[model samples]
Target chain A: MHFVDRVRQRLDDAELQHNLKRTRGRNAASRAAAVAAFPDFDAVRARATEIRARVLRDLDLWLEAFEAKATESGATVLWARDGEHACELIIDIARRHGVRTVVKSKSMVSEEAGLNAALEAADIRPVETDLGEYILQINDNEPPSHIIMPVIHKSKEQVSALFARVHGTAPKTDIEALTHEARAVLRPQFLGADMGLSGGNFLIAETGSVAIVTNEGNGRLCTTLPRVHVALTGIEKVIPTLEDLSTLLRVLPRSATGQAITNYVSLLTGPRHAGDPDGPEHMYFVLVDGGRADLVGSDFEDMLRCIRCGACMNHCPVYQTIGGHAYGWVYPGPMGSVLTPLYQGLDKALDLPQAATLCNQCSVVCPVSIPLPELMRRLREKQMEQGLRPWRERLATRLWAWAAARPALYAWGARIAVRYLRWLADGRDRIQVMGLAPGWTAQRDFPAPAGATFRDLYARRRQGRA
Target chain B: MSTRDDILGRLRRQLGRTGSGLAEARRRIRDEIDTPRSGPRPSPGDDPERFIGRARAMLSTVDGCATMDEVPAKVAGWLRAQGLTTRLVIAPAFAGLDWSGAGCEVRAGAAGPHDAVGLTGCFRAIAETGTLMLRSGADMPPVNSLLPDTHIAVVPRTCIVPDMETAWTHARAEWRHWPRAVNLVSGPSRTADIEQTIVLGAHGPYRVHLIIVG
Candidate 1:
């Protein structure tokens, strides 16, 4: 489907629009608060970027060292080349552990690898314990629409309806009521589950520790309650030391939700200590490459610098307008647009690269300064080189490119196009056309090209000076 | 591909010739290290009060919360007003408190899922970041703080620090003797998934009442 059409569909969903509006307002307020709180927010962002860059540059050395240290601490480390490999590794662990029920906190890596479906196919139940995730899971729908808020697409009323259907009881419209219901259901699963799965926001190479951040206590319960704890994370999550982690911790939550820090930041070094009263006995860390290693040396290496703060998405006009589902991936918004193409292949995600308006707001707001817009442009260039562009678009761009190279020809062409557009617009100064450009004007008016070309205006001004 | 096959394949591809041997050697090394180290260690070189100040600053920046002497009454009133009163699991730190006067039933120890409220005392409060750290143990079972409809934490004013670094140092020193899960809570649970709507109490406690006992 066309990008505009998909966005329109998401916008048409009243619940999504309502939620987006509220989240946008809250994020704005929180971000302002965070900025006010951290006068060194920019410095923290820069430091985080530098640390991440250093880690990515020496990824192999760090990975080997981290593996050695983690294994020494009595934790098993597994490497997966891609999502398929990651899923296989998890499934194997589940099979060996005889995992009948799995309780999960919010792990973006699991979502990316489609771990839930893979486990269920093997007859293992995967339960999402995060309140938002639980609501989405009960609905039995697609992956989360937002990175932090998985069910951002569902309104409280919609959630209430879904809960009522799943539990065979009328759900309350109140937020507390909804949360209480989810907690009631998930608490038992946390105790009964054979394995607990989570995603690490940052992995400390020096300490062999995985840092999991969450607001609700699910992340902690998921790691400590179960006999087996599995952490899935991209290789880019690694940092050199706890000091580096501290720098990131200072910035990530502030950038993400405008909090000084999340409520729960659990750093697990290894399995339960010998004398420790609680915590998992078997701890596994799955480091998935998933096309990230290739990005290490490429221009897109900066993408790895991301801490998944979701600030870019939060500030993105397109994201705020259409929401995440329109991107059609686990990682949505600008980061997703850049990553989906890289991981899923540009051909599979042809429309995603074009999802943005090249506004550059995403890059400006990005904590890590990934140059998202430039990377997106490069993806578009690659798509064009691959001849993936539609026939009509290719012809239009080709014609424009030809004219653009020669200013004299471009001026003449522009003059003719402007006259033609004026005629088409008649006296109204607006024209509704179908085909490729209709999406641009579907809900908003497209101003007719200015009556006078830039060359014409410039020449008239010069003449007036004469 | 099977999980074993996948893991084996990864091991072979990444580690080459030393993969199997290294795996075995690593396992042996872990088994060999049985006793905890008790050697004299260098000081961390950071000041406790400075870290506490930082914690306080962080909490203030993040809109940290604190309760006062009137907190018990406020909490009791809030819970009662919310029409929720079944059973409360109180932390050992809260043992000396007079709950009978507040007209609330309080049980000591971990709370079951059916329990209406879990009441505990925060070990440390970071004022800079506005966070409360709760360590799991006999008195503060992790479940007592989690797995309840409402979580009421009684944070002493004295334990409040300024930043996480101070909290970390204090926790690390405490864990050297007895290690357990340390939970740092900043605010009530929240989510913004539905069109980015910020909704509190997604999957955990919908109501978090801090009874700050000065």
Candidate 2:
């Protein structure tokens, strides 16, 4: 079975179709309300985009400056070129600290680097304290299908089952009961963990601070309770100053989840101060490049502007249909389609960029306004240039392009095809199956072409001139 | 030591190649000698109340709670209503509050499993971001705000500030004498991973109740 098909099967078993539909509806309504509520949302987003663009334009300089300042602040900074190196550095830190167990909040970069698996292989256990992440961990599952909501694929029934299995209790379908059960299970992990790990949403170069946003107090506890704290983040997650961070904080939650702000926004500069009563004795920031530096000065540079809001996915029809895991990466949906091929290389994930319908919804709803469809097109073009396009799809696109280049032939072909399609419909006005178009017709019936082709009608209308 | 020198030498070489090392050193020296610009002059349009209102709106979307008077009782009431037990750990900041009249055993110290709820007073609330600040101290153990089934925080009305800038100013002043972990909480623990269903209380407190003490 295909990757998407496997995800579909899981989603079906989990009975998440209704929940996804409801979430999409709620998200749409809330986003609309948030936009309406904050009339300055567009201005804020534009300002944020400018700020990010400026930062990326001079990223090398800013990064070096940040490193220098952070070093001065008594924080150790490690730069990783890719996921493997990132995982290695984090594991090395854990080893040095003799960390047996690690409590963590949500960090997409860590997920992207597959940190947990690496830590486990190194004989270190990493515990996820974020509610959604904790559920995913309990199930021994993959990184969340969504950026903001990791376990958006499971239903209450499935959660109840997972909780029951983990806690040795009978399954309870109530949402409240399931939440309580998870709380009881995770309480012990928080206290016993030796170190805390997190991801920074923004890194302020001005103050050498790592800013993390969370709706849970776990982010705070995870950073403060342990003797060692490690922050793993992508290089692009930096901003020039606190004022710039403020601008982003204003727009991030509103655009992502229709919230004004997340619950907890913690800023950590370095390890505990001399007089501080509680906090980690040691602090480390792992700045992972992971193909981001390559994006600088490139056509796809805007992709780095993402704040991991999952807004584009929420608004995407294809994502709404298939859900996240289909994209076969940490990220999924429209944003995932554009990002996967870029980060993983087009050769490795050729099918991803072609997944979009080019409806342009992702671009419109993006807080940074990334032009995702255009980027996908660029990826497709690159794939074709590399001769990696599937033969069938290549042949189809080639034929369409050829026909389109020859208007006379195209006009005749369109008329003939329309007539043939109408005949095939047999008065039903829709075709249940379309040869060579199974990807489309498999899900829904295609409407038969109208009586007269546009070319034919236009020609007839211009008969007087002829 | 050799590896460290090698890395440093490599960085130094890279800096020399870019011709930015000398410039950067000069810039750092200048920054050390120069004073930072004063806070952006407050505009006439900047209404603290209006800003607070906007910030509150943002906070509420993330499940931030606000209340008035009798914070402990209100918090206890909320927990009991959620079917949580009365056993709780009270922060030293609330030591003077009479919880005996509320009919609950409020122990003052770090939290335990028997403690279903934890209550504490926030040092300040930033209305610009709708965040409640808690600094780690003898009275406020970071775990008391977390690691419990439910968390109840008390924020006095006057402690609320308009934005992060103001909050930073307040924090800087407070941390001048003693620096510790400053926690800014905006709402309860929530996750949207399960089919985008917003589930509250995943790993931390399942529910958070805020009592606004005027």
Candidate 3:
């Protein structure tokens, strides 16, 4: 579907709006409180940004170190050039272990790779264990609208209806009751699953470990209990040392959910060792390239610093109004505007860069201080340079440029433009009809020019003063 | 050969690096790993009182255990106060704590589906966020604290570190060998998936009771 149509349709959705409204205030308030609690938020953020920049500069070296250390620690580190290659590697691991049921925690990397569908096609049953993710999984495998809260777009009542239909249990309208029902259904799946897949928030090179943070214990359960554990993470996730993990950790949970730290922070180095009573016997770390390398040292390289906190989406005005699905991919909001276009070609997501209002809220709240609006602006410029923008928009830009270069002609054009708009407005403050730009006024009215142009007013004032 | 080279080559190209200059970058990262740098962080001075205060804010129940031997009695009193059964799953790592006087049903081993309360000792207690860092091995299953309805963790007053950075420093200095799994658990497992309202014990412990033992 077109991005504009999706946005229009989403705006009309009362339930989605209600759900977004419920979280918008709470998330923003809690995040503000969490940020207030920190005394050195910006200083620590700068330190983290430097760390990310250092890693990106020497990412290949860090990966080699991580691979060597992980290999020595008895973990097989696999690399993939893209998402399809990532899915293939995961499938191969499943087949080798003769696994059937695979339980997964919330992994945006897997979502980007479409791992669930690939596993299903291979006759492997993939179960989502996170409460929010499980809701989306049972409801026809909808891609997450938010990264941290995958089903933030869903309401409790809708979830109750879903549970009654899917679990064959009575509808649970209360949030706690609904949570318990989900736990009852997923606990057995955790104990009985043959394999587990998770996404790593940070892959530590010093310890050759994969670290994950979750408010729910599902991540721990998925990595434990199951005989085989496979962690699929982006190559950009690798950090040089455990100290770097600490800095990122400080910012991640606070920015993600306004928690000082999530309930569970799992730092797993490798599979279970001899005499160890629990943990997976087999462990594999698949570092997914997935076009992340394409942004290395590019204009949008700072974007790779995102920790999937969902703060960008939480604070974004555009995201709060229209929600995430309208952006048309696993990622959305300000970060998505820059990332989706860069990761998936600019031509593929032409409207994403223009979707943002360029308010810079995401950049200010970002833990790593990524210049998100600046990156989005660059993407727009790239679109113009590559001729990826719509022909009419391009033509309009050209015509404006032609008139703008000649000051007298520009003044003359502005005078005529205001008159035409006022005539269209028919004495109202806003124009109800637009000739060539009907899409702009179709949904709502466009504010009309009041009287003469600003240039004319300034010129008349100068003459009167003289 | 896999796609390692392809991915790395792309990164190297973008970073404007040649084969001859790669060794210097590799050495720098290895040196960084050996002697890690400490960046700006919240100063959580090692104070047991502050730890208790923070833990309380996160909804964890804290009780004072005057000594290691008093853990059993303190836990027994806590369980009774909560109106929960005395039967608890304990990790063999805590055999030194002596839970015989707790007057509670104590089973030792990994957590099972039916266990209501799981008790274990943490590798270190982080005073910054009032979190317990538990490392897997030495007959102490990480799930003993997880995979249960209620979790009772024993945090030694002496083992309390100022923050995560200090915790890692202590782990490196003493542990020598890294445990397969290291979990930093705070309060209890929770979820705000439904309308952003927190519901504790979504899949883990509903209540996390901390006994501050000296």
Candidate 4:
């Protein structure tokens, strides 16, 4: 099946209907709570934007400071220009350590680099310990559907079936019981894993530290319990100081899940200290550039300011319709729409930039005020300019744009199209299908024109008045 | 060139930086970080009682004592009231305290997997987000606060700060050599990942009880 058809089928699933309703309800509550929690919500968002802009403006200095400080604090820092380089560094670390099993908390960079596959290729087992990520991995290792809430697409009954199938356990109906089952299954993995890997939320330059904000506290477990701990993050995550981190933290949880603070925010500067009895022995920080540097001066430069809050997707109408999987990559939704095309190259993601309806909802709710719709439009223009669009779509757009340039020709063309459509309606008043645009007409009927076009109607009114 | 040099060079080229501009930016960032400016914070009222109230509002239970000696009894009383077991694992920092009189069996070390309750002392408590700041050290490891289902953190009244900014100020000055880990825990571990339904006790303490010693 084609990718678009598969997405439609998934969207039509009854289970997805239940899941999206739950997601919509939760997002509404979170948006309300976020607004209520921060009385100066706009001011906080503006401050966060300024801080991010400053960091991006002076990216080199902050990254250098972070690298220096982290190294000073006894961390081994590595750099990766692309995903393959990053995966190689991580796989090398695992191989050197003779790591049989590695546990990872949710790291989109790791997903972007396909770290699990690389590790598996080298005879290493990569285990996902986060409950949502664990669920995704156990079910054929599908990429996370949502950035923040990975399993928001799965219903309780589906999860029950998966657990019963995977663990040979009794089906669980209670959410708490289901959670307990996951914890029971994952605790051993956490204890037995040779190394732990995680993604850094904010890389603090001043203290040479990296912060991971999580509600489950698995971030701590992953970074602490294992012998070797590694954090894979993009270079854009670097901020100047802890003070700046506090500013971002104030808005991050509030904007993301409508919480005053997440349950745990861990700041790890290095591996275990000299006298420390428990924690990781060696810490590694792999800074991945991964095509973000290419966007440093582009029109879509603001895309780098994203903090991965999933707010844009939560607020986007198109994303709400098609869901994250349809976006076809590690990142999804409005931010993903711009990012996937840029990171993976435009040729590989022709349909993603066009997934939007030019709705300003994503940008309005964006914490950093990233002009997501504007970026998507720019990508669409780029795609058109480069002839990346499908032949039919390109021809149709060219024909419309050509006709639109001349007012008289556009009017005549519209009048003729209306007459033809009306005739095709056969007194039914609505067209159920069209040969030219069957996909558009498949879901909903198109209204047939009753008589003359708007221009013609206006001309008649003017003549009657005279 | 090495990958590091290539990445840095690419970033510099993208930013349109010349030779001297990089050094100037580095110097400016150094100055910026050295003189840390406090960010905007919520007005949770300027009182210790307000801190306690806010902490409680985050679903963390709080109790206060007139002195450090009274902390054990309060801990024992809370455990009894909640109908929980009296077995507890206290951090070594609180080892000298007499917990035997409180009708509870307590030990001082890291929390094991089977341990239901663990106690540790917080470096500071921020009233802004109702957060407890725990720095990892020999006296109190991270597992004490993390592994147990119920974590009882003892926060001295002097350590309660108005916001996160002030708390960081104190942390930077006090710990010249920063610890390996600094955990800012707001409440018990919770996740909304399951169909966006909030569930507590997701791999961290299900309950966090704060004892404020004056």
Using TM-score as the measure, which candidate wins? 3
Off-target runs (Cα >4 Å) in candidate 4 are A400-441, A444-466
lDDT of 3: 0.89
lDDT of 3 by residue, A26-73 (tens): 787788999898888888889999998888888888888888888888
CA lDDT, every model vs. true structure: 0.73, 0.74, 0.89, 0.87
Which ranges in model 2 have alpha carbons more than 4 Å from their true place?
A4-19, A396-440, A445-466, B1-124, B135-144, B147-158, B169-180, B190-214
By DockQ, the candidates rank as 3, 4, 2, 1
Rank the models by lDDT, top first: 3, 4, 2, 1
Docking tier of model 1: it is incorrect
Q: CA shift at A272, candidate 1, in angstroms? A: 1.0
- Tens digits of per-residue lDDT for model 1 on A353-408? 88888888778767777899899999999999899999988998998898899999
Q: Which parts of model 3 are misplaced by more than 4 Å?
A: A411-466
- Residue-level lDDT of model 2, residues B117-200, one tens digit each, is 887777777665556677776778766777676777776767776666566566656665333455667656665555455677
DockQ each candidate and list the results: 0.21, 0.29, 0.82, 0.77
Candidate 2, residue A76: lDDT? 93
Winner by lDDT between candidate 4 and candidate 1: 4
TM-score rank order = 3, 4, 2, 1
* Total backbone clashes of candidate 1, pairs 3 or more residues apart or in separate chains: 27
Cα lDDT tens digits for candidate 4, A332-443: 8899999998999999888888888887888888888899999999999999999988899899999999999999999989988988898878899889997578988987
Model 1: CA > 4 A from native: A1-5, A11-26, A418-443, A446-466, B1-124, B134-144, B147-160, B169-180, B187-214
